[model samples]
Target chain A: DQQVKQNSPSLSVQEGRISILNCDYTNSMFDYFLWYKKYPAEGPTFLISISSIKDKNEDGRFTVFLNKSAKHLSLHIVPSQPGDSAVYFCAASKRNYGQNFVFGPGTRLSVLP
Target chain B: DAGVTQSPTHLIKTRGQQVTLRCSPKSGHDTVSWYQQALGQGPQFIFQYYEEEERQRGNFPDRFSGHQFPNYSSELNVNALLLGDSALYLCASSLGEVNQPQHFGDGTRLSIL
Candidate 1:
């Protein structure tokens, strides 16, 4: 059973447009959510994260919002550039759990000029 | 300073063979986590090591084992490798502090033929 799900297999956006990626989880115990960006042939890199303590977290153009009641989270990137094209994964973990993170299937985002 | 570093960027093995992958954590990070990423899927947690001890593990099989050195580097050993074990293995390092982000290595691509 997949505890985390990213239903969108891929996404496409024009450069300079806003891109939104969605993710959902079945476990209610997850308290911290994170987003990672990965290029082909490379490991996923940390992008942004949000703790259950807050509903939202932002880093420059990337923003993540968590909705505990809905067991869902979404990542928003404004002015998506060609450099932003890659796979984005949403992961969740309960605080103090020692990094036993659960990740979504991943959404490959392609930004076209 | 160098980020998390992994060795043998690529490897190929046959069924029933054993393979070992190595990683060196970023300077000053004490916690190391391992993940496996299959094609078209997000990475999955394997286990974590801290202070030269295995702190936590996920649902992976006993065929997957690991060790951490006093210098904070880590190694992952897989015995009786199966074709299902073919994936890109990633190593990430963190401070083990509550809510700290993990820095990842490029990963070692293992192909079980």
Candidate 2:
């Protein structure tokens, strides 16, 4: 069974707009959530993260929101740039077991110029 | 400083064969984790090594094993490779602390013919 799920397979947004990607998880033990952006032929790059204790965390243009009660989380990138186009993966891990991560299928986000 | 580095960007093996992949963790990182990512799916955790020991493992079978050297580099070995074993193998490294985001390598693509 997939512990984490990213329902949308792809998304498109024009530059300077907000791009939102959503993810859900079934495991309540997960306390830390992270988002990674991957470009073609490269490894996934760490973007932003949110702990279950907080509802939101923002880094520059990237913001991650967590709704523990709903077992859901979302990543928002405001004023999206063309460089933001890539595959975004949502990952989750339990406290103290942070080395083992469960990842979602990923969403391909295209930021149009 | 260099990020995570994986050896043999691509490999091809036939059924019943075995393969070994290597990874050098990012500088100052002491933990290594391996993942298998199949096409159209997210990465699935294989196992993690810290302090030259296997601290945690995923649902993968004994056919998948790993070793972490004192230098904090790691090797992933798969025995009796099957066609199903074909996938992109990713290596990630991080500090051995809780909630640390992992840095990943470009990954080694294994093809089983």
- Give the clashing residue pairs of candidate 2, or none: none
Off by over 4 Å in 1: none
Top TM-score: which candidate number? 2
* Candidate 2 TM-score on chain B: 0.99
Query: lDDT by residue for model 2 over A7-113, one digit each (tens)?
Result: 99999999999999999999999999999999877888999888888999999999999999899999999989999999999999999765699999999999999
Instruction: Judging by DockQ against the true structure, name the best candidate.
Output: 2
Q: Write the per-residue lDDT of candidate 1 for residues B2-110, one digit (tens) a residue.
A: 9999999999999999999999999999999999999888889999999999998999999999999999999999999999999999999999777778889999999
Q: Which candidate is the best by lDDT?
A: 2
Model 1 lDDT at residue A32: 83
DockQ for all models, in order? Answer: 0.80, 0.84
